[model samples]
Target: MVADAPLRLSDTNACVDAVIERVGKNITLGLPLGLGKPVRFVNALYQRAKDDPSINLHIVTALSLLAPRGSSSLEKRFMGPFAERLYGRIPELAYARDVSANRLPDNVKVSEFFFKAGSFLNNVDQQRNYVCTNYTHAVRDLMALGVNVIGQMIAPGDGSGQVSLSSNPDLSLDLLPLMREREAEGTPVAVIGELNENLPFMGQHAAIAETSFDVLLEHQPSDYPLFSAPQMAVSPADHLIGFYASTLLRDGGTLQVGIGSLGAALVHSTIMRHKQNDDWNAVFDRLRVADRFPVATEDGGTEPFREGLYGCSEMMVDGFYYLLDAGVLTRVVYDHAGLQTLINQGDISQQVSLDTLDVLRREKLIDSPMRARDVRWLTRFGIFRDTVEFKGGRLRVGEQSLDADLDNADSREAIRTLALGDRLTGGVVMHGGFYVGPESFYQALRDLSDEDRQRICMTSVNYINHLYDHAFGTQRLKAAQRVHSRFINSAMMYTLSGAAVSDGLDDGRVVSGVGGQYNFVAMAHELPDARSILTLRSTRQSGGEAVSNIVFSYGHCTIPRHLRDIVVTEYGIADLRGQPDEQVYLRLIRIADSRFQQDLLKQAQKAGKVAPDFTLPADWCNNTPDAVRQAVTRTGDEELFPAFPFGRDFTDEELTLGKALQTLKAATSTRRGKLVTLWQALREKDEDGRYAALLQRMGLENPRGLKARLDRRLVIHGLRKLDTPSDTGSKET
Candidate 1:
């Protein structure tokens, strides 16, 4: 009679059976992007499909995280131990593994809306099935494809009587209402959740009642370690690019950055500006940033933050954690629209007083004679103490009872004496949708107190990415919160016409899906005080040669010329928001690598975008590979711009060997370079046991076969150079 209302909570295998039974053979199950998928349930279902070819299963998702499994013998030898140390027993998603290796059966199909940034360049199957959609539009598109079942990894909660959608509330919170609507329309839709004890419990909108799920699975066998990717080294070019971008951030602004060393570099620079203002000022003055591009000085700052920033990134990378620790991300915003606006206009301080109540009363957010709802709202934000209670239109403080009329002077005095708090509560300093980072980041989050963890709200992507929807608040409130916002993202190639190439190539093969880059860029144009800053190295190595990332034109564009606001490379900054064609061309060319400026200028002249007789400026023609290196050296900050600003998981031997191997790989990328490397390796007189530890780490200490001997020789040759350049730039196909 209750229609299975006893609350069916089972294990992984039982839940998999229930899902198949409810959704039938042709199930288009939906999974959350990244670390939130139910790995055990998904693997069981995939095995069922693989074992029985009659079962048709098509799944849709994005950013499927995979642990490293090196492709070749040499790479395997290097990464095997490293992988075991990091991702110990994390269960790899069977569908992702199969789809990546082109080993899926005929009856199983998997598609993703995003890839882990250039992980699928030559993958024909993944490139073909990739669904291109903005991050905010994922739920609508997933529904259009007839997604019937959904599953997620959840924190079962620490006796809080709620389940927390930790790590990912991005897509599932947006898709749940539609799934319920379909169920009401006589369609079979299953909502399943698998419990993981490792995820940190995220409160607020991410926590929901346990009755929300149709089936809940808590199994001991499924308890595995969460995946933690190794943090890579930040290059010298990344530091300078980050420094240039840091100059553009205003005090008390908003920030949204992606996950990687580039964003960490920017965070490092921002922290430097805050903690070591003298050094930051020194670097700023030495680079002559104000002379060539006055926008950095006029529109930005070189001093420290008087009022800290608010983080509004969709992915809460570890950089935000660092900022929070350094007291740089301490600016918080409340949920009340009127109060947020007042805070933005500086009418009331975070410190609560009689003035705050007066402002709220004047704004008519609360009535003179407070109702129950009004009293509850005030107490919820800690404007009033919990000791204050409302009963029959009267206020009850700890030992005093008084009338609740704020317009009356006696009642207001009573409130100020007993009910008012010193500061506001229920304000968030950061709002993010999903998060993925190093193991240390996860541990830091898990170790936070309940009070501190709730200050970072992990909510739906709809609320975080754009202000078009009214699910959370109005666009006006968002505008007030996101003041002078900076959305810094990476780019693959930039054209002289001010277009950015980020996701794909001209041949229509996607390097990564258009996940949220377009959403943020379009949002940057919509917000009046906001700017989109695209960062890239001035040059990248291809075929053992440095090639300019700034080109005349590219076949495809991610952000069109009309949407370009700011572009930052190691050379300098280019302001391109509302400039003319000639000005955009000149500014972009001036920031290009010095070796490629003339060629780019000639191409622009051939296209008639620039004048035929235009001459390159003298001051902007010194953007060599070593320019940033030398500038950093002059400032005596080589130690500050470390290879890994954050602590690393790699061993000491591994770090040295990894860099040497990278140099060798670059040296062997071309035919001529390969010949030179081979000849040099053959004649290497590495007799002195200088590379004994490195050789033993790579498993090449004693060689037997010809291949092993060659590997040993290559290792010896790779170890000959220890002073290799630190700026191995970002690469793309």
Candidate 2:
């Protein structure tokens, strides 16, 4: 491999062959999570390992996305066309598919720090192999495993000797240092990049010289479409959860949101608060948000954003785009520590006024007579015009050179007149590690102007996930940029003791890896004004039973009781940051579903965690599913809570059918529920023309067999149930 240029290979097999020759048969491959995995090269390498049993391949990564496959026949029929149509030419990850099906070759062992949410619930292999670590420690863990080969899908630059890590620079940027160290030690190591034309070429820290890679797989076959995640329907419960969480956000603050419908809901609510304050206030008032939970009014706000928000998240979710479109995510933080600190302190504005340079001088950041280095630094940060030149203790503009000394009044005037720019450039509105979403998200990034694209920096996870960054960003800079921060994420359950269960079940089945939730939660405690918020539905349908997510105790805890902060459900918000155990129990129960509150309270009382004499308040007792539905529907505003806040990939028919299928699946999850659903389907009337389009879509219009007829009847029953209004979280048919 050349120092100035990568060993470019157009063929996938050639790249794999080069890697094998360099790293021998025993290869420890480290691929980036999600969309950045170099599919072609990895497939070829894995194939080689399979064919030659002597080769041992250990692949380590997270969220290796495979196209969705439905288990039942009807689900397959519904999802088949949708998946094929959306992800037709996209290269499927053969490793993920094999690993999922438990058919991995004995020689190839795969490990992941994070699984796609709920992907491997019953797989003992995945559960046993799951690496428990934060997102910040992924690089460290990979190095400890002696990873020698790194693979990624890169975006091409403008014919320069550069490329953007594009969707994922997360671990690759962090691992570069270690890879370099191995190379210096003469240890065989490889960095392979497969170029994709569809990948959005993001700049900032994501851009690096092509020499970073030792092997390049660049051609048509390898440059397939990137894997995309379609938008899921945001339930009424999710919207309510988002609405409650939105009130906890300060106007001028920092935000860290995860990827999913819940995060999207929060962004939508925030947008509504900013754009349609009247509608937002109506919902807030109707829900008695201020009256019940004064923490919202005391710590958070309900008014429009005057200072806006700066997004500092691990994943650059599509919701940020909606917020950006609404002019709500406009708070930009600079790269320089002093400049960002001044902006945060209100000592200087982004507009390149004379105060910008004056503040820098006052902070002892620059000399009275600016040195050549100071001139370069000012121009680099957009404080000065590029046309202004500093040489020999003077400021040069075209032909005229004036005194550069700020102490001289005449020189100051001359410098301000010639060197000032309109506003600050190089300030980033969002700092993210990686992203995966619907086609619109990728297209949105592709369609952005170069100037606009730079506003959302796709950098290493070390930068956005925590404030302990020594490379990409410093603790001081992150602290200064983040003010009154709200770190929002989703959890599956919460205990009365204030512990949060997010990643896995008590049975030792891995649902998803603890990627950055722990990092943000710990950081929230460290930051003076920041709060970590975990959101979940109050009640969820599990095995056809309405189970309470707020439990008395849980075996697995992602966020322990000591680190508990804010938790939001459809009913209300529970601030458990500094509260006692009994107070935590009371607050959690008040926000739980009305049906389960009694049992939860009884359990708490029996365990001596809460007062047995304490009875539920009448106002809090109405925290039911119907109450949440009535609250949203009574507003008479459709735009207040939408299923798809940003644009959706699903069509109207698909949306209708998908929702009905979900209700059917939830209703019939257990034997008793299935029997009841079967009885309902047998009595369902099919003479109506209302479901003609839906029947045609599901291929149940003209059934030729008994199974087909039964499926048709089930479809009709589901469609009929869809017309009836129920709680968003209710799975009952």
Q: How close is every model to the real structure, measured as TM-score? A: 0.96, 0.96
Question: Per-residue CA lDDT of candidate 1, range 62-99, in tens?
Answer: 99988787775667778888888888688888899888
Worst 10 residues of 1 by lDDT: 724-733
What is the C-alpha lDDT profile of model 2 across 1-733, one tens digit per residue?
A: 3367888888888998899888899899999989899898999999888899999999999999988879886788788878888888887888889998999999999999999988888787888888999999999999999999999999988888899998898888889878889878888898998888899999988999998988878895547877889988787888899999999999889999999889988988999999999999999998889988999998899989988999998898988888887899989988877788888888988778877778899999888788999888888888888888888888888897988788888887887888878888888889889999888888988999877788988888988887887886688888888889999999999999999999989987889989999999999999879999999988877786789999989999999889998999999999988898899999999999999999999999999988879899888888877777767678887656777778788888888888788878988999988999999999876785889988888888898899888888898888888887663445421
lDDT of 2: 0.88
Model 1: residues with Cα > 4 Å off, grouped in runs: 1-10, 723-733
- Model 2 lowest lDDT segment of ten: 724-733
Pairs clashing in candidate 1?
Answer: none
